[model samples]
Target: MKRRAHLAGLLALPMFWLIGIYIFSLVMLLVTAFWTTDPFTSKVKPGFTLRNFEQLVANPAYLSTAVRTLVIALAVTVLCMLISVPLGIFMAKIAKPWLRALLAVAITLPLWAGYLVKILAMRVTFTDAGFFNWALAPFGITGPSFSITTVVLTLTYLWLPYMAVPVYTAIRQLPANLFDASADLGAGAWRTIRTIVLPLIKPAIIAGSIFTFSLSLGDYIAAKFVGGSTQMIGSIIASNINLNPPIAAAFAVVPIAFVVIYLLSVQRTGALERM
Candidate 1:
């Protein structure tokens, strides 16, 4: 009984935070999604209606924005994965200690800066007369000038550390003998990575992907600063949040649903356990 009491006391604050704060907020948001607004006064009222959801489904603009956001999220996740795997391998197994430390600092440096600061930095880089254009002008090339491509790149820059750190740690934890054994059997670097490294580190990759993907899905600030006229799911939610809050709430549920679906799909792989 004493041990059980001690465990319960230790768990008290976290359980309260999880249930009282996080879960309560989510429940409120879900409840708000089904609510209605007064047409004349624009005030929220206590009544259930599916009209907001219907609007989301019927509105082509909303549908397109959701699809575009999904694409951008997937693109960022893929880019992070592609870059992280090779970078992690080099940092973990090949780079000298000093170089590895330097690389680690470089990867995490962006996280130290403020979020808006990073977005503005990307904005400056891709502006019409910004560094990107100035540098590429000699080659007769030009910058993308704040398009969906720029949005994807900005998001990747912001979230790369989340993906890279885990992948690098996972790779570092791999038994060194696995590589030696594969080499002894005449397997090349690419072959060894394909057969061994990738399979072992997949959980970490998935764990990292969850962060990048969900963050990209819900981000509006990056798009607002560096996306030119690009619209994302968060853009719609922000626009409607004041003028039509029920619609905003309903739209907000889209990203939540996508994340829940993604978690469900990846749960079988034990990725959530890693997180």
Candidate 2:
């Protein structure tokens, strides 16, 4: 009883924050989605209506934007996975101790900077007169310069740490004997990674993917600075937030739904439990 009481006390603050702030905001967003806006005044009113959701499907631009956002999110996740796996393996198994520590710091360095600062850095890097274009000018090549590709690159840069850290940690936790045994069994590096390392680190990969996907899905800032003419789901939500809040709320639910579906899909693999 005493231990249970202590545990409850320890959980009290976080539980309250979860229920009171996070859940409460989500509930409010759902409720707001069903509300209506006055056409003339452009003010939100408490009422139930499906018009907001209808607008989502009825408008082709919104549909395209949602699809584009999904693609970007998926691209970022895949890029992070591809980069993190090799990096994690090297850092955990191959790199010397000092080099490993330096690599770890490099992986997490971006996270230490402010979000907007990093986005601006990418903005500067890809701009016409920025480092990217200037460096490639001698070869008569050009940078992508404020496009969907830049958005994906920026997002991958922003979220790579989330994916890399966990993957590296998981790989580090793996037993060294597994690699030795795989080698003894005539497994090459690629075969050993495909058959052994990947399966064992599946949970960490899924966990990292969740962060990269969800963050990229809901992000408009990166798209704003580096995407030029690209419009994402979050862009629509931000635009309508003041003039037609119900629409914004409804659009906000799109990313939430995608994330929930993703979680459900991954849950079957027991990844969520491992996380």
Candidate 2 clash pair list: none
Tens digits of per-residue lDDT for model 2, 7-124:
9999999999999999999999999999999999999999999999999999999889999999999999999999999999999999999999999889888888999999999999
| Candidate 1: Cα lDDT at 258 | 93
Q: Who wins the lDDT comparison? A: 2
lDDT tens digits by residue: candidate 1, 1-275: 99999999999999999999999998898889899988888899978899999999898999999999999999999999999999999999999999999999999998999999999999999999999999999999999999999999999999999999999999999999999999999999999999999999999999999999999999999999999999999999999888789999899888998999999999987767766
Spell out the clash pairs found in candidate 1: none
TM-score of 2: 0.96
In model 1, the Cα lDDT at residue 57 comes to 88
Give the TM-score of each candidate: 0.97, 0.96
Clashes of each: 0, 0
Evaluated with TM-score, which candidate comes out highest? 1
* Local distance difference test, candidate 1: 0.95
